[model samples]
Target: MLVALAIRDVVLIERLDLVFGPGLSVLTGETGAGKSILLDSLGLALGVRAESGLVRAGQSQASVTAAFQPPPAHPTYALLLEHGLEAEEEIVLRRVVQADGRSRAFVNDQPVGVSLLRRLGALLVEVQGQHDQVGLADPASHAGLLDAFGGFEADRAAVALAHRDWRAAERALEAARAAIAEAQRDEDWLRHAVGELGTLAPEEGEEEALAERRQGLQQGEKRAEAVAGALSELTPRDRRGGGNPAAALRNAARALERMPPPNDSIQPALILLGTAQDALAEAETLLARLVQEAAPDPRALESTEERLFALRAAARKHAVAVTSLPELLERLKERLSALDAGSGQVVALEAAARAGRAAYVAAAGRLTERRAAAGASLDAALSAELVPLKLDRARVTVALTPRPEAAWGPDGQDRVEFLVSTNPGQTPGPLARIASGGELSRLMLALKVVLARGSPVPTLVFDEVDSGIGGATAAAVGERLAAVAARVQVLVVTHSPQVAARGAQHYQVAKSVTGERAETSVTALLPAARREEIARMLAGERVTDAARAAADELLAALT
Candidate 1:
């Protein structure tokens, strides 16, 4: 419920702070006493569009704040949590509007967008008047209201879940169908490619390995020619004759040894010749080993080149690297396997989708049945309230029509609307169209009385709903407001003393002039002050003895 409202520099309201409590509270005063200003100020704080004219004369800005203490399960609390905002025991909504028409909004002291504040405001309080454009005035909320009244939350949830399952199954089936169609379109080409790839059987890194082996073989062939030439020169067929360096060196050493008996130079020459012969023998043995080691196998080289070329050509044809060939082959095999199993998979998915649709249809059908019963009960309850409000010849109807399949939703297939007829032999139409301002207000009141238990809003404000009616009808309106207030907080701006007398608390709005400026003030009236005010409302500018006595009688009867 709204706990307090504060206004500063808003039109005639220079500065006003009013604390509120639960139950019926009435704001009453003479006409032009700024009663509407109070409601407008509350609207500003609730995120209505701000106007520059709302700022008081010579003031640069205006501000309004509304504080609410709603229950923990209130939707506003959930909204705050969703926005990552703080949800304390008391929720304060503040709006500041500058004379330039710029505005800012805050929730719980945290800056927020006007849209979010408006959303939260709608959940916290509902302001109903002849010109109200929010809440039940919008036909879109009718279905939700009916569900709330019918206690169909569980049924609605079941339908929503079934709808989700149906959509998911349908999506899966569509994807499968598309995949199978594409696979069938390319069946022949895919089979041929798969056969060719399977024959080639490409291996990872085989290209690089084969290229390296081929390079080594080509290099070996070049080196083998030089090694063979060196071996032939070093080791002649007849080592004793041509290219016989070892024989020649040994003969020289023998000659030197024989010619010089004890000469030092001749003995040194023989030792050098012996060393040369030993070196020649070692060179022949090393050269023979080089020839054997450098020999290349022609067949192995040919095979390596063939495999490397084959991998490169296949990689180009497939538009992939040689290393990716293995992965591509695996994927193609899987696709082919899926194609072979596509018919059975498609059949199974279709069956699942059908089951999902059947579940949704069943749930929606049950919800529709319940709504039909609840609508009838609601119509009866509202019809009972009409006669007391002086609409004896009028009737309210809850219309439930089946929507087309294209318009079906998670909430179910029924479109709910509240229709009314104000006189006999008149066709019933939408409530907004059939009722005048006074009639609409009474109809709304009756509907609210019927729906009070299901409404989530903690506060309901009626803006002079008793505009053109009085006497017993005014008293009846007061009684229904009291009934609604028993369940939720109600604030009414009224000229009816009977309505004012029914208030659990009464506030009188009065305009005052200070210096050259006019300002509005609100006073919470005690029992005596309340009686005087109600007497004034009854007597109109003169509180007669009979009016005061009547006021007393009204208050006493309320007790």
Candidate 2:
């Protein structure tokens, strides 16, 4: 609940501090007694737009501070926690407006932006006026209000969860469909590439091995020519059939052995001839082995060269290194496999999406049914309140219309609106259009009375909600305000003595001139002082004996 309001150099309120208590409190004074200024100051503290003109004539700045003590469950606590600010037992919101029209805001003495202050203010208090610019007047908030009144938070949450799940499933289905479409677009190319790569079957480092083998074969061909020429020289096919140097050397040694006598020279010559024959035979054998080993088959050399060139051509065609061809092959094969299985995968995704949608529809259907029932009950309750507020002819209706699929959301499929009919046999219309200003205030009051139990705001301020009505109608308004105050703190700025008399606390706003400066002050009236103020309201400029007697009667009736 709002505990206090302090104003400094704001308009006519030069300096004032007013402490507020729970229950209905009425602020009463003559016209232009700065009641509006008081509300303006409160609005400033609540983060309303600040103006330089609000500063007093001799002051450089204007400031307003509002103090509140809200319960733990109030939304302000959550807002405080969200901003990384401590939620103390008491919360203070202050706004300062400079002479240059600049302003600053603070919550619990921690500097904050005006936007945050306004947000927190909305959750802490709801200011309703005859114009109905805030709170229930907004059509966007109607659904949330209906849900709160209907106690359908859990049902609504369930529907929200289901909606999220349905959306996620839809996204998954879309992604899978896109993947399959892309794969299908390239299906033929993928299959052909896979087939080509499979046939080639290139391995890592196979290029190097093939190149080495080809080089060895080319070198062997050259070496074989050289070895054949050398062997021909040693053992040429000439006129003497397959004669070699070893045969010639052996003939020489035999001739030497036959002609040798006991001469030393002849003996040495025989020995030399024998040694040359042995050396020539060894050379001939070695040459034959070399020629045989150097010979390479032309078919094998052609095959190795072809394999090496094919590997290089495939690598260039695929825009990959020879070593990476195997990996690329595996990847293409995987895409092909996925394409083959895509139909089944798409079917599974579609089924999941369908299940998700079904679950959401079921949850929303149940919630809509319960909301309709609750709306009916709320309408009946609000209608019961209308008769006493002098709107016995007015009827309230909760309109629940199914939203189109395109407009459906987490809140469910129904759009809730509060409709009203002021006279019998007339079609009900929206609340803002169906009633006069006074009637609308009363209607809002009736709704508040019925819906107060679900309201999270700790304070409600009604500015002249009793405008242009008096007598029993004003009394009815007072009664309703009192009833609402029983549940939460209510501050009403009014001129109706009956409404003022109904207050658990009464305050008188008065203006005075001091040293060429005008100032507005708020005084919490004692019982006797309250009677005089109420009498003043009843009697106008002059307080009459009869008016005093009526005020006393009014006070006595409350007991």
Candidate 3:
């Protein structure tokens, strides 16, 4: 419930502090006396758009602060908990608007976005003025209202869970289908690539080994040709002077042995000839080994080239390197497996979706039954209150229409609308469409009285809701508002004496002059002052004895 409001430097309102309690409170004043200003200030504190023009004529800024005491289950508590603020303590909302049209909001003195403050404010207080009832007019609020009235909170929870489950199953089904389709699109390419890679059978470092072997063979081919040319040049036929390198080296070594080692020149020549013979023998052995090993077949070389080119082509096709062929093959195998396994996954998802649908149907069916019963009960209760509020001919109907597709909401599969038929032979339409603003306000008052018995909001503010009502009906409206106040805090702005007289707390809003400056102020009325204010409301500027007597009677009746 809203407990306090403080305004400073606001238009017409210089500085005011008003404390409210848990009962119907009235703010009564003559026209143009800033009654609406007070409410607008409260609205600004409640996160309404701030206008720079609303600042006091000479001030740089305007501010309003509202204090509320909401229960643990109230919406403000949840929001505070979400923001990691203290939820159990009192909630203080402050709004400051600068003359430049910029504004700042604070919750519990912690700066927050205007949207956040507005959301928390909604949970704390509901200002039921002319333009503030769009939520009530919304179709979504109907099922929620019904749920609150029918005690279907548990059913609503179940429906929400079922909807979540259905979405989960739907997501699973969609994933499986997408996976299978993607795998199918690439299956043929995968198979062909895998087959080609298996045939080629490339290994790590294969490229280096093949290139080294080709180089070795090419060198061998050149050396073998040189050896054959040397062997042919050393032919044993009569045309050559030396039959072979080995024969020449052998003759030289024999001649060197015949010479004695004592003569210095002959000994040196003998030693060189022996060394030459040894070297020639080594060369012949090397040439023989090369001839035996250099059997490099062209077919083998061509095979190597073909395999390397195929690996490269495959790598390019898959946008990877030859070294990654093995990994790509593995991926291909996995994708095929996923395509095969996806069929069974789709079946499982379908079953899960069916189960979720069944659960939703059961929960929605139960909630619908309860809503129907609640509608009848609410109709009976509100119907009884209607006649006394001068709406005797208007029938308030709580209409619940089922839409299975729409039923997929957190509340369930139904759209609830509050309809009214003012008289006989009139088809019921939406209350806002059928009734004028004044009539709707009266009806809303009746509804407030009815719903206040079980309200989630902690505070209710009605601005000029009693505008078109007077005499007995105005008194009745006050009586009903007071009845609602017994449950939650009620704040009303009225010009009617009967309503003001019925307030447990009466406040007089008036324009006053202080220090040669005009200002608007509000003061809680004392017993003697309240009587005079009520009399003023009755007789305007002329407070006669009869108006005072009428005020006394109204106060007496309220007591």
Q: Give the alpha carbon lDDT tens digit for every residue of 263-354 in model 2.
A: 66788777888888777778878989988877889798999988888988998998998889888999899888878998998899999999
Q: Can you give the lDDT of residue 543 in candidate 1? A: 85
* TM-scores of all predicted structures: 0.79, 0.71, 0.74
RMSD of 3: 6.9
- Name the TM-score of candidate 2: 0.71
* 214: Cα error in model 3, Å: 22
Model 3, span 21-116: residue lDDT tens: 888899988888888899889989989889998899989999999998876677777778888887767889999999998999998899999999
Candidate 1 structure, TM-score to reference: 0.79
**lDDT by residue for model 1 over 1-559, one digit each (tens)?**
9999999999999888999999999999888999888888899988888899999989999999999999878888889999999779999999999999999999989999999989988998888876763566667778888888999999989999998899899999999999888888988878998898899899988888888889899988989998888777665567357666666777777777677445676777777777878888888888888888778887888988888888889889989999998888898887788799999999999999999999999999999999999999998898899988888889988888999987888888888888899999999898878888778888888889988876788999998878888999999999999999999999999989889988999999999888988878999999999989988998888789999998899889988
Q: Candidate 3: deviation at residue 306, Å?
A: 18
Instruction: Show where candidate 3 strays beyond 4 Å.
Output: 81-88, 131-135, 189-335, 404-407, 453-455, 513-517
lDDT of 2: 0.88
Model 3 is weakest, by summed lDDT over 10 consecutive residues, at 233-242
Give the root-mean-square deviation of each candidate in angstroms.
5.0, 9.4, 6.9
Model 1: residues >4 Å from true position, as ranges?
84-90, 185-338, 544-546
